[model samples]
Target: MEKSRVYFTDMRTTENSNLQKKLARLIRKAGIGNIDFEKKYVAIKIHFGEPGNLSYLRPNYAKTVADTVKDLDGKPFLTDCNTLYVGGRKNALDHIDTAYLNGFSPFSTGCHVIIADGLKGTDEVLVPVSGGKYVKEAKIGRAVMDADVFISLTHFKGHEITGFGGALKNIGMGCGSRAGKMEMHSAGKPYVIQEQCVGCRVCAKSCAHDAISFTDKKANINHSLCAGCGRCIGVCHRDAIKPADDESFDILNQKVAEYTKAVVDKRPCFHISLVVDVSPQCDCHSGNDAAIVPDVGMFASFDPVALDVACADAVNAQPPIQNSQLKEHWNESGDHFHKVGPNTNWKVGIAHAVELGIGTTEYELIRV
Candidate 1:
């Protein structure tokens, strides 16, 4: 197979060109303009950083991307689906509020922020995966599927579950609706955390299958009757419902690639990933650890798989920062992500994507 082109630009800034400007140049050079953006609704998928995580991509980078889209006559909106985990961004209202709090307001990014999933994280569009083994039908957020074009703006970092949360993780897991997220992460059933349950029956009211029952003021889920819609999780205010992360790490990676296919298939898609702050975990966390390695740079590509491989290789090439997490877990010859996160392997997802025809892992990194 022929190699895909992955463009790279270092973080160095001259007196005239800043990081944001460099980002704009990077994407443009990577061929973002090749897509037809005229009068189209473009979804720029992004993470608006959980309330206190300071390592997420800044609004300045988002603004540059949005402005570039506007320059091409496209209507761009900064968007992300609701997360499965309970946090500041669990619902649309809270998600937007958190985005604004994290400085992703319209005034800052030259675009509007839209929570792809509706208020309770139930609004979804059922998208079929053409060559899926793990996910036959993916439940993606409605607004994300509603967009005329798709673009992923990812903050590349070490992830406990996926080894590294790169383009695939950002698009697949990020685009999944509440139930979709449950399916990717687990077997699609949620069990109540008995200690946190007040037996208020708020979850019982939301269950479509009458699977939830209370005994001794603690709610329990009947897996036999449960349909796994995950609505009960959305309605629980006491943080009682916890979605199971039972899928093996490698299986989770493959499911993420399949869901990513559901999101980008039949749509004009592009991706950009920033390898900075190299956080030890996903930005979904309220807190973040120190950089595992020095910032590599920015990468952009039309092929999500190639983009991820290029970014991973760039990080591997950089020496680990002293006293960093990667430094602590340093293995002499293993891949950097595997050294940092022992259980998860990002290559599993990239390889699955290759089998699914997403893109080739073989890439040519062209420096910009």
Candidate 2:
């Protein structure tokens, strides 16, 4: 396979070019403008940062990307699907509120923020996954699947489950609707946490499949009737409903790749990952840990897989921070992500993406 080209630019800022300008320069150098952006509805997929998680990309960076898209005559909208987890981003209203609270308002990003899934997180489009082993059909957010062009602006960091949350995770897991995320993360249906149930019946009201029942003012779930849409999990105020996190770490990674292919397939796609704030887990957490490694550069590519691999390679080459998790496991594995997450081999998703013909693992890193 021919090597895909990945572009890089360091964090160093000169008096002339700030980090934002450098980011614009880097993407342009990587050929982001080569796509036909004129009057197209472009979806810029990004994480708006779970409230209290300070490590996610700033809204300023989003502005630069959005402005660039506008300069190319594209109608850009910043977007991310509602989360499957009960948090500040579980529904469209909460998701948009969290975005604005985290500084992603239309006034800041120079674009609108759309919760890709609708109000309850049930609005989804099931797209067939080509060459998929785990996922035959991927349930992506309707707004995400409706884009004329797709772009992922990812925050590259270590994940406890995926080894690393790079471009593949951003484009795949980040774009999935609530149920789509459940399909990737769980192998079984949701069950009520009996201890946490408050007899509120909110879970029952949210269950369209008649899965919830109450006994002694506590909730119970009928798995036979459950579709595992994960709506009840998000609706319960007490966090009573919980999905079984039974999927193997490696299988979860493969499913993410399959979903990624479902979203980016047959579309003009571009990926840019910022390897800063290299946190030790997903930004889905209400908080983030210290950086595992010093800030690395920005990277961009047309191939999501190659872009992730290139970002991983760059991170592994850097020295670990003294106070973070990577420092303790530095001697265990040569790969930085693996050192942080023992079970999650990030390579699994990259290899699976290659097998699914999404992109090549081989890449040429051209420093900007």
Candidate 3:
């Protein structure tokens, strides 16, 4: 197999060219110029940081990408699906509000911010893929499916479950609607813990299928009626609702891979990952921890698997910050991320992505 090309640009900036200008030039040199961007609806998928997280990519970089798309005659929009957990981004209205607060507004990025899933998280398009482990079809956001092209502007960082969240993670789990996330993470059975139920009926109000009801001052979940959408779980104030544990960690990884494949199966896709911040956990948390390493820089590729592999390798090659979470496992050599996050096998996602014919793990880094 030919070595996939992964373009890289470090933190150094010339006096005339700022980071944003450098980003635009790097992307052009990375092969985005090959695509016919005229009049196409391009979905620039990204994680608009949860309200309190300060380590997310600034809106300036997004603006550069959006402006470049418009220059090529493509209509671009910054997009992301709602989260499954209760937070500022559980629905379109609140999610958009959070994005704006985090500086991802149309005024900031030169494009509209569309929550891919509609008003509630239920609005989605079911896309089919053969031989999937946990899902036969992925319930992706309608806007994301409607777009003519897909581009991911991802903040590459460590993830608690997947080891690292990169290009594939941004599109796969990030594109999934609330219910779709439930399907990917577990067996799709949500239950109410009686001990934590306060009989507030919040969960009942959020259930679209009338699957939740109150009996004896406690919430009861009717598994037959529940589509496993997980809205009820997020709405419950007492931490009552929970997803069942039928799938193991390994199964979860395979399921995520299948869903990811379903998302970009036949799409004209491009990916860019910012390997800065280098947080120890995902941005889904309300707050970001201290970075575990110095800012590495930016990477882009036509191949998502190769992009992620190169980003991980670049991060591991850096010296772990002395007082950060990476210090916990500095003695382990060769694979620093694995040693720091033993429970997560990020390689599994990349390897599975390759097996699904997404892209190859072997790559050649082209420094810009």
Give the whole-model CA lDDT for all candidates, comma-separated. 0.92, 0.91, 0.86
Q: After superposition, how far is residue 196 of candidate 1 from its true place, in Å?
A: 2.5
Q: Any runs in candidate 2 off by more than 4 Å, and if so which?
A: 198-209, 234-238
Candidate 2 per-residue lDDT over residues 82-120, each given as its tens digit: 886779998899899999999999999999999888887
Ranking by TM-score: 1, 2, 3
State the local distance difference test value for candidate 3.
0.86
Show the colliding residue pairs in model 3.
39-73
* Model 2: lowest-lDDT 10 consecutive positions: 233-242
Give candidate 3's error at residue 166 in angstroms: 0.6
Q: In model 1, which runs have C-alpha deviations exceeding 4 angstroms?
A: 216-218
When summed lDDT is taken over every stretch of 10 residues in candidate 3, the lowest stretch is 231-240
Strongest candidate by TM-score? 1
RMSD to true structure for each model, in Å: 1.4, 1.8, 2.4
Which one is best on lDDT? 1
Task: State residue 114's C-alpha deviation in candidate 1, in Å.
Answer: 0.5
Tell me the tens digit of each residue's lDDT in model 1 across 1-368: 99999999999999999999999999999999999999999999999999989999999999999999999999999999888788899889999999999999999999999989888888899899999998889999999999999999999999999999999999999999888888988965799888899989988888888999999989999999998778887777876897887889999999999999999998899999999999989999998999999999999999999999999988898888988898998867778888878887888899999999999989998999
